[model samples]
Target: MPDFSPTELAVPGFVALVLIEMIWARRRNPRAYEPKDTLTSLAFGLGSTVSGLLFGGAFLALFLWAWQFRLFDVPWSWWAFALCFVLDDLAYYWVHRFGHRVRWFWASHVNHHSSQHYNLSTALRQTWTGFLTLGFAFKLPLVLIGFHPGMIAICAGFNLIYQFWIHTEAIGRMPRWFEAVMNTPSHHRVHHATNPRYLDRNYAGVFIVWDRMFGTFEAEVDNEKIRYGIVKQLGSFNLLWAVFHEWIGIVQDMWRAPWGSKLGYLLREPGWTHDGSRETSDMIRQRWQERQGEQTKSVSTENPIAGEAEPA
Candidate 1:
């Protein structure tokens, strides 16, 4: 592993590319640019940028300590780096899968899913508390195996940069061979899709192969426009809300319900319906339509005199 500087390694190029996508998306569809959604993106973008540096800094500190203690001889060969890459990718698969499966981890990850648009800006909507919660711990095995800390950081950064380009609707499926082995824009779009069929699937970070191999892959279907955002939409631009809204909902459910259902609500699938309660998606839409109909009736009632006042 060559010397790695966390400060230098942390760049805003990803965010810049995402901004470009935002501009392109606006030009393509004006209605897609919701003010609240953009504000949430802005907050998440800033938080992600800051958090990336923090994660890098933490890893750098750990690397220094490991080197000082002479934990193991740093492997600097091509074969060694290659091995590290493979192992890191495997670790990342589990890390990402766990992030979706566990409630606490999902709290940080939910911000990424808060967007209703699939563009580069949505890619910048990342979790900030990941390192604080030891999300990086999954990479520890590489260090234990004598892969240089620098190599781990470099490979991780490379994987992240690779993922940035796929977060778009601008590109579709690649050739069958590429689509089979790689994470194309189509796969990532499905990952972002909120359709019942797509939810919590395609959690692979760098490669779509893991999802396919692990039976988590779901192909995008034609004629079914993907509805983005979580099943329970987060209606806020505040960073805190973007991060913790689901967590708050989880806690609220736990507070109001018995322990068994509380645990079940989180651990079960995302759209899990209790014996008596409907899924949040159905409930929200129903309530919205009810309120809309009531408002229409009230407006008609108030305007009745206008029609009767003809020549007055």
Candidate 2:
């Protein structure tokens, strides 16, 4: 193991600055992050930084050693970095998709969905154990293909930075071409939404085109407003609870459910409501509005089902 200088310190600094600005800007409108939200975000953000960097560093070492050992006839070029970006993102899509579909991965990822507001601070509310689970598999190809360890770290960091700005609600849809090709605020908000239509939809990181290409793309519908947070709602803001709470709930749900339903709840799509409940969030919300006899505001105009996970 080589001495680590905590070079990734800048990642957290960048995150903090963005969070501060989000606070400053939202102060007037008062949609700024709530105190509990801030505390939870900080806990996960710091926890993830420590875990991701340490795990990433260890993998970085292995990547370096593999290159030095001449495991493959490696090629270096600007195009290689470009390829790395694509491959890295492709790997991310699967990992992210799995996170929503698998009860265990959801344990790690649920903290992110714990946030109700989609802002830069929301991006920092990441999972502490995600890197330990699905994130590393995506990087393995780079090592095997002989991309240098330093380059891999650089590309990973660069991808992280590129994704930061996509967290904002300030930016609307970019030009049609840009939105079609890349992930933007609009697309990411759809990813964060829990509205039945927006559940488990967009999973792309830097490129929205992947979702478009792969049939996961959902356009933002103007009439429907965005509501963030996971289904079943996280009632607490404690970081530890936020991280493990879903896993605990899944266990409890499984224990209480019949054996078959228990497996179905964890393995099947998240929207498969327990106890054969027919009404989804969409139905409940619409009925509530109807009962009130208010003019119906469109659910989010964004594609409803934007980020729904694949069934088990």
lDDT of 1 by residue, 59-118 (tens): 777865665545577558888777777778878888888777766567677778888877
> Candidates' TM-scores?
0.76, 0.77
Candidate 2 lDDT by residue in tens digits, 14-109: 667675766666664467567678677778788887887678667666666666654565455789878877887887787787777766677777
lDDT of each: 0.73, 0.72
User: How many steric clashes does model 2 contain?
Assistant: 21
**Which regions of candidate 1 deviate over 4 angstroms?**
1-12, 19-23, 52-56, 59-74, 259-312
Worst 10 residues of 2 by lDDT: 294-303
Q: Report how far off residue 248 is in candidate 1 (Å).
A: 2.2
Model 1 scores a C-alpha lDDT of: 0.73
Model 2's alpha-carbon lDDT is 0.72
